[model samples]
Target chain A: MQPLVLYVLDLAADGAFERCVRRVEARDAVLSVTDLSATRGDGVFETVVVIDGTPQALEEHLDRFARSAALLDLPEPRRDLWRHAVLTAAADLGALRPRAAIKFVLSRGDEAGDGAGTGWALGFAPSAPPAAPPAPIDVVLLDRGYRHDVAQTSPWLLQGAKTLSYAVNMAALREARRRGAQDVVFVSSDGFVLEGPTSTLIARIDGAYVTPPTDLGILPGTTQADVFAGLRAWGEQVATRRLSVPDLLGADAVWLCSSTRGAAAVRSIDGTPFTVDDALTARLRDHLDARKK
Target chain B: MQPLVLYVLDLAADGAFERCVRRVEARDAVLSVTDLSATRGDGVFETVVVIDGTPQALEEHLDRFARSAALLDLPEPRRDLWRHAVLTAAADLGALRPRAAIKFVLSRGDEAGDGAGTGWALGFAPSAPPAAPPAPIDVVLLDRGYRHDVAQTSPWLLQGAKTLSYAVNMAALREARRRGAQDVVFVSSDGFVLEGPTSTLIARIDGAYVTPPTDLGILPGTTQADVFAGLRAWGEQVATRRLSVPDLLGADAVWLCSSTRGAAAVRSIDGTPFTVDDALTARLRDHLDARKK
Candidate 1:
């Protein structure tokens, strides 16, 4: 596969939309030490999956990106510019591999700069090819340390925003590994199932695909939305509702959905195993892989 | 004053302790977009004040830095190497300015690399000279969205450690600004006074200087420790105990203590004015500025 593709978007204080993006070598240092992203993690980001030279759910990802920026009180990202950058990077990387991931970031610029923001998009193929039928993952439930209503009660906590300040998320993942699990599904302090550190929780309870409501201080999942749409098209019931740990434990099947990785079936949680439906897992993978936009 | 000074520490997996740091221009881009600090905020950091070519509380800052690293499960920082880098940057900046701030960061390295970490130190003088007797700040109390016991209940929440994932802290500062306040003091959801977004809370209650216990999931403030030392030397009572919002409102005086800025008195809380103890504030400032280590 070709090496990673990188582009730094020269964001302007006033909108200057055309021809400002510059392609750079991935190894080159493209961020200053004083950039707020590096120091404070004061930024927002989105990851889009590329399939056969097309960025899947591009507009959805951009909408969520802007929403996250608004939550952080950052300048509204110019959508057309970000779209061009994502599509261009996706095409370049997709030409090298059928499936790739592209992550775009908009930061609150350098602390020493003129208060203008910084932006960039980077695309790369996964080191290993996607596992057919999607490999099943083991997850441990971890306490997210916030009540379910935190987003509504406290906006400054930034719970619903997809921010670059993911050190806690990363630490939770590490905690999962330390517990001999592959991933984590964070549980709210009040006993509701929140989303994963980087993915959305989708559980098949009572033969209906249900994900947690976004109002519970969690991200609105882009891939989970697509999966729900596909499930509905197939005449299956889909929903957004609160799921507790017991609900998860009683589910027939469960998966963690995300942009690049699509859906990875959760095989067990906290050492409790659930019967894996291989046929349905394959069907979900097919549904995700079939996306063209 | 001279321009900013920066040094990128060449960290080795095996710990090469001698002479591996290199200075670079502060304007140069020195971090990769894929570095965990930029992407995930998966890092730890410390800031120390420099005065007259000496880094203040150097050992204390390094101790806290190592503590933060251990909390994140990062490799234990080589203190000697970090000491060398911090002192070198401090001396360079201190030569130009009587007082300057030096921040050092250690990040989990590039996602695509060999798992080696990345590190750098940047030093710069504040834009304006210190306000005489220190400026008083108005603060609004914001909900931090976690119970005070979270640090003990959930280490994964990363409370007590000063990680680079400060997006929520930055957001709180912005919220404070929107509310017409100069700063924020984040209170726990349980109604106990926690700390400031970037500083430690010190309240003079009932003739004693008190700060919240570190067990409450807040940073062990280096500057707060220095302030306590000074208070004890003056035969004033100092203690670490739990303080609630009501206790804070009824306090004789309150201050936010940090490394570079020392102690900035909180002139008011939620617009309720506090009596500024000018003599004590000046003494605290003098005590902080008098550090020679």
Candidate 2:
């Protein structure tokens, strides 16, 4: 049986995680009907990798989580309380270390209803890490229906915040699979490359690391940030810009990276194949693996 | 306590809502955390007004609900079961008749996790009907970040579907409130007047009733449709086209119409006041009120 654990949030308790329990058996009643997260999709969450009992880039993830919560105007999460819960979960699911998925979710509690905000941390046996593609993966480009500058021009769209309002993102992924593609990269209505449905895209161009700027309304990728740090430490150049599809195609090498899937070599974009550079891929992959939290 | 009713889907039972419960109490445990609706906002819902214990434009709402569910690739909702549930709820909460809100929710269920699709119908005592503004209501015009033709060109955006990913809509309303206005009328990035955050904007210009076309990526308004039918019966000219701020400002009258808020007379848009023709407002108001189911 897979190991699953849950912890109810209690910020004021001396042992914040004291209410935590192993709920691998009970499979029901985890959400109330009135929770705004369910009713209005008003919440923020993070899914992190736990490698060998250590959550990778956890502090970075939590920081982004706090930022998202703030944007949603929810109360600031007690990071220490969250930390204790994660640690307790890691200890409980210690055997699955190096591979577990640890999820931290903070929902805008039941406002104008029966409850307050709800936050929880759950851990489970991780699936095996994503494997590299046997061949170049196929991708379809989709329109995200926003200008390249909507993030600056329209804060109401909640760009750069990883809110739970991801129905469109999920639909794009499904559209990808339906078209026999493995992934998708969204472009602005103005044709600037944004980011992947759930991952960040990075292009190695002209001996420099380049990705889309956050001003384009793309999320600031935590994994991308980590990889940039590693690249800079290795004396490689890194930069951000308004990347277009042509720019990505012309790059020396391109990859999609996230917390769980360390580095994925994109095979193709909208059916256009790219030659894989073994040396560049190896270097980036090594750096990403070494930098894991 | 306010009235609340629920129905659960049962594929095994001949009557699909056989296991339904009229739980006007118990405020907890109506959902599972693994539900994609709560997790990813992957779901579709319709909010309908119940008048005299009957749901208004239910068939139209369910048809649109079906279309939205299809866009999300959700399982076809058991409409007969939902109809049964809504009728049951109306019967149970009948005392609140002529003023109740009935909600139909069809979540994409659990994906990449536990559970399956969850469909529920809930009945709640409606909040008091929207009041007549002492003066015409004030509105702030905001940009929706899509072009007028985005709805026709981009299907992946789910532009016309009433999906539960409404965080942006809610945010726009908040922005309007923050700006000291009573409502918001969203304009396309390309400067076409689209629709309100939740209501539809209809204007009277040159003795005709005109609303922005759905080609602008606006939600198809059920209430607007009803009012349009009534306007036609009354021999008033009705049309749909790309509307602009100038078109609205130059109109004889403007009103935001929805099921609960039948006619929200617009006093000012972005601080510019428009004359509210009493004749047009009264005619539309009478139609909106008489058309309720």
Identify the leading candidate in terms of lDDT: 1
Could you list the iRMS of every candidate?
A: 2.5, 2.7
Candidate 2 wrongly placed segments (more than 4 Å): A1-3, A10-26, A125-136, A277-292, B1-3, B10-26, B96-98, B112-115, B126-136, B277-292
Q: Write the per-residue lDDT of candidate 1 for residues A1-293, one digit (tens) a residue.
A: 22388989988733564466889997689998888899999999999888887988999999999999999999999999999889888878877777888899999998888788999998877766766766789999999999999999999999999999999999999999999999999999899999999999999988999999999999999999989998999999999999889999999888899987788889999988877878777787788878888
Which CAPRI quality tier does the interface of model 1 achieve? medium
Q: Is the docking of candidate 2 incorrect, acceptable, medium or high quality?
A: medium
lDDT of 2 by residue, B1-293 (tens): 23366665542345435664234342546676667778788898988877677778888888888888887888777778777777777666567555677777878775444446776677766445445533578999999998878777777788878877777887788889889998999988888998887899888889998999877777789988988898899888999988787888788778898876776788888877777766666776776656545
Clash count, one per candidate? 2, 7
Instruction: Return the TM-scores of chain A for each candidate in numbered order.
Output: 0.96, 0.89
User: For candidate 2, what is the TM-score?
Assistant: 0.91
What is the C-alpha lDDT profile of model 2 across A69-105, one tens digit per residue?
A: 8777778888877777777776665674556777778
DockQ (0 to 1) for model 2:
0.56
DockQ of 1: 0.68
